[model samples]
Target: MSPSQEIELTLTPAQAATGVVIPVTLPSGPQRLRIPPARNGDLVRARVGDTEVLLRIHVSGPPAPAPAGKSGALGCLVALAVAAVVVGLVIANSDDDSTPTASSSPTAASTYTPYTPPTYSPPTYTPPTYDPAPAPPPTTEAAPSPFDTGTCLNGQLPDSTTAQTVRGVKEVSCSADDAHYRVIQRFPGTHDMSRCDANPRTEYGFSYQYTLNGSVINEYVYCLVGIGSYSRA
Candidate 1:
């Protein structure tokens, strides 16, 4: 047989809510009892299991549960019934869809006709011809060169231009000014600059020749492109 007893206890504001299991002294030993939330200074007489308890609840937040115990119990029973009915309906619906038969399978009837999409052809396309924008006009400023006629006429560059490659008597254009060094003039001829034997340390110059050795021989005035050299071609 379960032992029963009557106990008196006071509940703080924190412990007065429903589902709060509070410890109480019993004839057998200390046992925890669950109760609903109550208002401050509320005197409650509720039987928790086989033990009867008189509780004085003090709470600061929400009002206590409805004072009529019989109506509250009736409302709980109605809620449980509604919940059971909803669960039963859900379970029935799930079971009905779990399996299928030949009769339940989708089938086309004699009057049914399959759908046919209309034939479509993309329109013929001819890509347009494209002509890119015209290139920028050629630069007017002439790049500096060895056979600059202006520098040659001005005597800015003379026989002191260095020859990277010497082709006998080939006329070339010049544009850069050799203003840093003095121009050394050479007598027109087809001669290696080494034959001139001019030292660039004291005097800098090279012997250059322009005009092809063909039917008629031709000569040109010399000019300068850089330091320590001349274009006498």
Candidate 2:
């Protein structure tokens, strides 16, 4: 590194292999050095006349795809395949040995007990003699449906004039013009009366029908309250 300390190096081709050899000589003096070799981006390690100095080396071309020891995985796979083949061969041989061997000569007929069917007798059927009787005429009219008039007392809105007749927790009223009839009541709101029955009030051309009992009525009341409280009036 100083001005007086000078070193020179030269590279020559080796005759045995396609590799280069570098020879370096230090200045004539009593000296000790741990110096490294000259770095030229080549695939050979630089050495001082075949003497390694810091082992500076460069390798060209792509690295080997797999390392040497990694072949054990492939070897193990091959070994397993071979082992499977060996085991399969062993099993096949065992099966071949275990099976009942066939003989060239025909075997004697089996002396099995013969199966006998039981004798069954058919029964004789006798036909009965018929006596002609006068036939009665069939009833034409269908009997009235017992629950045909099963109308809910609170089912309909009464006419205005007939409003005074029926009174309960429920109220029924109609306009004088008969244009609007409302059956407003706190009836049992257990079911969705609008579509509850096959023949609902809506189906019969009634204005409105609803149940007014239990949780359903409570829900309706709560909804009405909520609407009234939050409505933009």
Best by TM-score: 1
Name the top lDDT candidate. Answer: 1
In order of appearance, the predictions have TM-scores of 0.20, 0.14
Every candidate's lDDT: 0.39, 0.26
Task: Let me know the TM-score candidate 2 reaches against the reference structure.
Answer: 0.14
Separate clash counts for every candidate: 14, 3
How many collisions between residues are there in candidate 2?
3
Superposing all C-alpha atoms, what RMSD in Å does each candidate have to the true structure?
A: 22.1, 34.3
Write down the worst ten-residue block by lDDT for model 2.
Answer: 86-95
Q: Candidate 1: global Cα-lDDT?
A: 0.39
Runs of candidate 1 with Cα error greater than 4 angstroms are 1-6, 17-19, 46-51, 58-233
